[model samples]
Target: MTSGGRRAVTVLSGFLGSGKTTLLRRYLAGHGAGVAVIINEFGAIGVDHHLVRMVEEQSVLLQGGCVCCTRREDLVRTLRDLLDQENSGKLPPISQVVIETSGIADPVPVLFTLGTDPVLQHQFAPAAVVVTLDALNAAAQIERQPEVRKQIIAADWVVVTKTDLAPFEAVSRCRMRVRQLNPTARITVSRLGDGSDALAPTRGAVRGLPPEAPAAPHSEVQSTALGFNAPLDWPAFGVWLGMLLQARGPDVLRIKGLLDIGDAGPVVMNVAQHVVHPPEHLAAWPADADGSYLVFITRGIDPARIADSLETFQRAGGRADLSVRELA
Candidate 1:
């Protein structure tokens, strides 16, 4: 929720066949209560919303143009309509809103619309950005499409789908590539019969993740996840992070991690380009999870260099070895 007590908004975006609708279906089935959903599809006929079993009355569809492109005003108007309806008691009070963008759409433009639109900004706050990546085709898709990079870079959480259909090596490479593009996004592999929690709105933190300039050099994106058993020095880490962002904002796409900040059980920090969302403290470490798990996604930047830099900044003396044989 925003400081004004407005409903939070979550944008679910990904490339075509990335299992976005599938994830949205599961999310609606489990957590649709008091939630308003906006679905956008590129094609003229919109069928994704029909797949959702409930909340037909609360669902709005924007078809033809992608929400981030030609139909942007429609999106703004639709959001306003939803707000007016709730205020007039025409529709049930919305505790939250989830927008599923057309597969081809870039989430950043839509994010700009929400953040800059005076009316919607006051009534709703951007809560999270969830992106789905197809394990079977992500490697090729990333190579062929620049939109994929922007989608991953703007993501708060990335769900890797269709792993069962792809070879283990292919899946590993795909996941690694995704991490490199958006270091801060929490990535989880999706398996058949996976639960709805994967798509549920992530609580805490409200900040925007803007895309990098279009002129970034052509290079393969890379990701590395590091684990630490001890608490991180927040002050030292802050200084290092500020310097890193200032120096290499374009090369660094995203950084998302759960940190053991001493007395606090765990705190989550998300950084995208130059923006750093306020860290959120979790109630406790996730089940069976120990210490901190930090993920970094970068283009033309080596994970080893980043690890070494952190060691230097924190004055930790020795460098920690990161086993890159598998995804974290």
Candidate 2:
């Protein structure tokens, strides 16, 4: 539980055959105590919940629909009921909640539901989004499926599973593809569902950008890394981001960075589609980060246009000399 007494919620998402259940089952093996799980399956019958039930007894199943669309209200009511049970001694106290989404589901709507709900917003706080990527089929799946790309983009930590079955080169390429789609996610390799470390509650920090990789074949998703030479006006940047998301939320897939808002330390920013999480202010900057930098994962948008708009916004905020450069 967080200091605010809210239970931490982790959203597990992946495409079909991405090893989501395998990784989740492994995670629940050792951390089942004080943890509750909600499994969402698209079909009329739920099978994943049964697999998870082997390790955890406090599990709920939502069937016949995807959590992102038809099952959102069900998700709300289930969470409330869990709270009621814990309060009344019907179930053990839950410190963490894991929501495993179906293969075709988009995670942004789940996050939106949690943030916007009246009772849920106060009782639950987002911990992290862990996504599973199949090492052998990720390249083809990412190229053909928009759902796979969205899952990767919304992930905070992406676990590349089935590494033992895939060749070394295939795993390398899979990691590169995930980096292309979501530059901020921490990528790790796992064999036989041993990537439980990915579920650790720590957020993946901005460890400077990796070497640039060629654009994925037949994909419009591109990541642009921008560095600001000077501190930005936080209010002005907020306005610009708000208007940008309002206009092009779908095109702008993800935005994550550490910003120097003329404070003693940097302010951390994370966004998925149109949902902007509350900015975290640190007492000091991390040793690795030299200055403020933002990586934007976008589709069908020119990187130059984004840089120009940010520069224009900063200038209007009285920082005319604040130069924004695209990192190589």
Candidate 3:
């Protein structure tokens, strides 16, 4: 664990043949000092763990199930065991734990297990969800596989892999699709797992929001960017968001924004489905940030409706002059 006594966990997820292993192996090559890995495979035998073991000795394998489903308890147990071993001096002190999930897994359940488990919550803190997308097959896979879309929507950073083999147009299309699915996720390109830096722990880095992409005709997921012309009332916004998430949690895939609440800096908000990360208060706004804005990734929800709802809620909260406009 770090000096704070909590081990930072990064969930690595991607569809089959998306080069998840390559990225993990590359990352461990340089930063495997105090890292432990938990590899979950869908079948009876686990093979990825052995490959990763070449670089890092502290590795555990969970076989026969997906971490998101049947292996959730297994994951919790593995984590608890790691902690126990560290405490008892059976294993070295682990500062970071990397959970490389099966290709078909949905990462949301893994996060839920970590956040809700009474014992694990205090020992582990989520660092990031890094996903890999194959440039050659991303568009087709995203269109055909629901899991791929879910993984993309849930990612904190997405790496488009196999760019060297795929044509330039295919890579561009894949990036566009990812942007449409998760506007706030940082997207990077990689050839032979060169984009391993995306796995590095973020330290309140200011990520400039990507320009909104046109909605894909074949995909149900869409992103909406909303800008507030004035500072917001924090308490009122909380109430509005709480009610909204309670009512339509599943439909809301991701919510990320920087809110100006009449403070010297902005409040950073990140939400993944029902999981609401604690809002971070920055000392000052980034130089590039012009004003408060929010990006919402939703399915089967109208962007205009969301804008109207927020405007109504803010108006009711005494911000009659505050205008909520959909950013172009």
Candidate 4:
């Protein structure tokens, strides 16, 4: 264990079934001892812990469907344990920490907690928010899962996973979609989470003014989400979203909502730049609400124009099957 260098933490995140675990396993094999891993899994206790515990020297586990809402305290406790071990000489000084978040976990809260949490912030240095996207399933999942969209939008570096299985044509299309969602992210395509360099600064992890400040103001590009109380016709709303994405996906970083439409009591909707998936029907709203609610997040874009497009969608008769090209 080394004491002169600062400890780095990397958030390995992605949509469900993305190869995050495999990536961590690979990274750990290459790097020697003195690194700690914390794995968080969704629901019914994490199986990843039992499987990987044998391989790694030091590791902790947190299991729950939603870590942000329920198990935040667990993270603090585990981190403290690692630090204490480091101090006692029971373990080698931990040089780096890598957290594999549950598929549905939002990386923002994790990063914020890492920086703002008084106890941990003082001890650890922010490293990178590394996200893995399945070259085969990422586009469809991004469209169907709001959680997935947030993961991509919040990433500093994105690894296009499963590239070997995808043809160049398809991989190129996925990369294009990712660019529209995150214009500034460093993207690398990998078959097994391989990328150049061992260290990279994560987005949002670095706080404070840079050497050169941006010429534009924050208002020039703002992201906000709006919610709806009632559900509109699914077919009609689909048409509205279709037209909206086609017209402004480049400017719209993300969209997420749960709709109450017809028999689709609870429909999960997500949209990133060029990719769209059929709405996922969740178990039902928390209550028996009869209306649909929607939330949209956009940046450097005007909402009034989007409103006008929605109006046009309703006027032209809803076309649920509408599809369009990805906007640049």
Report the C-alpha lDDT of model 2 over 226-295, residue by residue, as the tens digit: 8888999998998999999878876888898888999998888888887887777877888877788888
lDDT digits (tens) for residues 1-328 of candidate 1: 4445878788888899888777776777677777777877633333344222121112123454233322257568788888888789978778778888878776755655666577876777678888889998898898889888888888877888887788889878876776556655667888752534655555523222222222333367766666554566778778888889878877776677777767646777776544565566766776645457667777788777887677666665232332221123
Better of 1 and 4 by lDDT: 1
Better of 2 and 4 by lDDT: 2
Candidate 4 local lDDT, 1-328, one digit each (tens): 1122557777788877777766776677666366687777642333333122211112222353223322255567778787887799877777777777888877755655555457787787556677888889876887788787778776667888888888888788777766656544567788755752332323222211111112322343443333343334667777777766667766665554455565634675544333342355655453433344333446766655555455456446553333221111
Clashing pairs in 3: 1-94
Using TM-score as the measure, which candidate wins? 2
**Model 2: lDDT of residue 251:** 86
Worst 10 residues of 1 by lDDT: 51-60
Instruction: Candidate 3: count the clashes.
Output: 1
Candidate 3 residues 201-281, lDDT tens each?
554223545346555633677788899889988888998999998788778888888898999999988787777766778
Overall lDDT per candidate, in order of appearance: 0.67, 0.79, 0.79, 0.58
After best superposition, candidate 1 residue 203: deviation in angstroms? Answer: 5.4
lDDT of 3 at 84: 87
Q: Model 2 segments beyond 4 Å from truth?
A: 42-71, 205-218
In lDDT terms, how accurate is model 2?
0.79
Candidate 1 yields a Cα-based lDDT of 0.67
